[model samples]
Target: MTARWGNACDIVVFGGTGDLAMRKLLPALYYLHRDRHLHPQTRILALARARHEPEAYRRLVRRHVSQHVASADFSEDSWGSFSARLDYMPLDISQRLEFARLARHLGDSPGRVRVFYLATLPDLFAPTALHLHGAGLVDDQARIVLEKPLGESLATARRVNDQIGSVFDESRVFRIDHFLGKEAVQNLLALRFGNALFEPLWRNGHIDHVQISVLETVGVENRGAYYDQAGAMRDMVQNHLLQLLCLVAMEAPVHFEPEAVRNEKLKILEALRPITGMDVQDQTVRGQYSRGRRAGETLPAYYFEKSVDHDSNTETYVALRAEIDNWRWAGVPFYLRTGKSLAQRKSEIVIQFKSVPHRLFPGTTPEGNRLVIRLQPDESISLSLMAKSPGRGMALQEVELDLHFDEAFKRRRWDAYERLLLDVIEGDATLFMRRDEIEAAWRWVDPIIGGWQEVYRSPKRYAAGSWGPEAADSLLERAGHAWFDERGD
Candidate 1:
């Protein structure tokens, strides 16, 4: 289905010369343009401190775009047209006076959809918004997109929200968590709410537990400085994993509109059982990776990584058991784990159903049914169920009924940013986070961080190539559960 593209718009990307823009945002826009999703008259104006002419900036963008964008999608003809829409304006985001130049570049195009994508640090979010407003850049039809790691804590998140909210209304603010844009992530809503198969059985009585894991094979590479300050909790758990949990656990929205969908997600965040005091110690595991091997190559520990503090107590890995107090998922626990320098790179959500009341086959043990929704490496959904052996008396084995996205759908799969950028242009906030939703998540996450600071002196150590610390296994073992290893089957 083609998305409804709005009228000609201006997408002004702040920090356009930065890593995120060069690697992700630009390429995503290129794909949108290639697929004919972008309006013909749409203009992509890049604002940054780097002084470069429009042609020079386009050439610089071409190198990164070619490296990141797939060769199959990158045609000379497409790049020619895509580059025409790209413009560069050298202006420091911190300086309010420079925004007037941007305003002149944009001109007084009435009713033009203006999007200011702040791809810079969280500190710049407010200042950029204020300057945009001061320069008469922000209007009723204008929208602003804020990147992740919104703040260090709830108080700071509120401050950032207030500043951004001052310029743009809640409806026009799009706080992006790129994970929300994944095809499988959105398919989750369709699998539950759109289909009649699972919604009836999506409760504690039917589901035994849920596991959400986002493991990375590579460490903090060049983001060591940011990784040190944020760690796994603030970086991944507070936003990505919690957002995933809400989608899996939230009650069906009355409608699929922006507010209706986000309102239900907010309810889940508020209903989350707080992990504090002794519960933090018992229900959470924090770890830092040590030297290990990956693909026959030696890898350094998190502390030894470039730009990282050698004696930092910051955690590179976190595993927590989360519970929702609502009726739908009252007793069910959500096992959440995310870390760097792990065994493999994969993000998946496992929904294990309750076992049968009685064992029909005395000789064979029946495995419980499970729905595995994989988000990376491959986007697919597999239902695991016990089936009778081909030639045997009362013999059973677990088999997966799979739907691999690439194989199931013979079409080009879009990168997360592609869909998300398009949504912003179309003024659809369905996939974006709302103000209340952000605050609610931080409210649940803040206490756990405080508890860790007060109690734990240091993060546990685990080998770089391993899944996580031994404590993570123990966290699940205590609940009579285990981490589902995709490679095992």
Candidate 2:
């Protein structure tokens, strides 16, 4: 479907004073506004318990936006024009009376497309929807955006969906997974389907294994309480990593529209070989970060993090082998891993092709061709090829043909949130997760979580600055493969 870009819209962000608003949402909105991507009649309303007036809130937003957005992009002229569209309201969502005030504030603009972005806790998602419905604000033009950690498990996710679905139709609900909005992730689709080179060989016979890792150098700073309960598995793997896996493994859709794309993703999630019973122990590795040193500074253990239990058994890392039980990817393994307070900050996917049938070089046994798609620490796609060294008897050396997005585009790349927020405003659910997609992800993840509780009482410990527990390495080593480190090796 085409975007509803020209339509007048109202963008209402709940928890407008929260960290997500300051660091991501508002800054993204600022860029959209500066670029004139937003409709001329569009109005942005931020609702929070903070009692700042509209002008004061704009000033506060200006400060935060200036800090988060690059100085090269920020300017007084743009802020002045953008701030004209900004407004604020103070209300407690839990209070039923507050809805009346919000409805009255909106002043009966049924023709305007309304987007209610819930940047609050997952628990607030359903209630906010119900409140909006009761407040007579759930018109046909209204849409709702939900943030991640949708629920702790499948049951809770269904519960949230049922509750929110009761108020807003599934089509009007946007389940945001910011990872899918990244240019590199979208380019995976382009690189696969757009190019004739990869599709034919993108199967088990040609590709050996896939490695998807999202590593971080920073620990759970203020989210220790949430992290302890959710951990790396629920927080990162269930949504981000699985979504990446789907994009890599899904079949070519009939068309590039929302349902067509999501249907393919659902098939991949359903075809995932279930890691249950004894399989979990063999295919999965979980670890908690312990105190260690990185660079010149010492990093604290997960247990010592603020709001975390001292003896928390929560895992801060996860590595698992996921297989698609389909014709295209039957035997190929997709290694998914993510961790906090690790050696580096990177989000990348490594597609390792199978080795050549015969070695042509007499002295050198060259490695297979590899494609690396990096999403963060710079967005780029590089293919590793074996090239002959200078003046040698068939000596082979690995070289990369890299296409960095910034260098090639010669323009600022849109932050994931920036693109996603604009998509939501324009009523495009192509990048958003469907209700079935969310439940399907939870269905695949729930069994492993149960396996962890039943079989492994405590996660294995690894140094904070290390890649992960040694077991993660061995998880691949058994298959004669190794986790591809950041150095492209």
TM-score of each: 0.97, 0.98
Counted clashes in each candidate structure: 0, 0
Q: What does candidate 1's lDDT look like per residue over 1-489, in tens digits?
A: 365456899999999999999999999999998888988899999988999999999999999999998888788999999999999999988888988988988999978899999999888999999999999988899999999989889999999999988889999999999999999999999999889999999999999999999999999999998889999999999999999999998888898899999999999999999999989999999999999987788999999999999999999999999999988999999999999999989999999999988888866457789999999989999999988878858688889999999999998889999999999998999999999988999999999999998997599999998878999999999889999985532
Candidate 2 shows a clash count of 0
| lDDT (tens digit, per residue) of candidate 2 on 1-489 | 233347778899999999999999999999988887888788999999989999999999999999999999999999998999999999898898899999998888867899999999888999999999998999889999999979989999999999999999988999999999999999999999999999999999999999999999899999998889999999999999999999999999999998899999999999998999888899999999999998889999999999999989999999999999999998999999999999889999999998889999876678999999999988999999999889948888899999999889987889999999888877788888899989999999999999998997689999998888999999999999998895422
Off by over 4 Å in 2: 1-5, 486-489
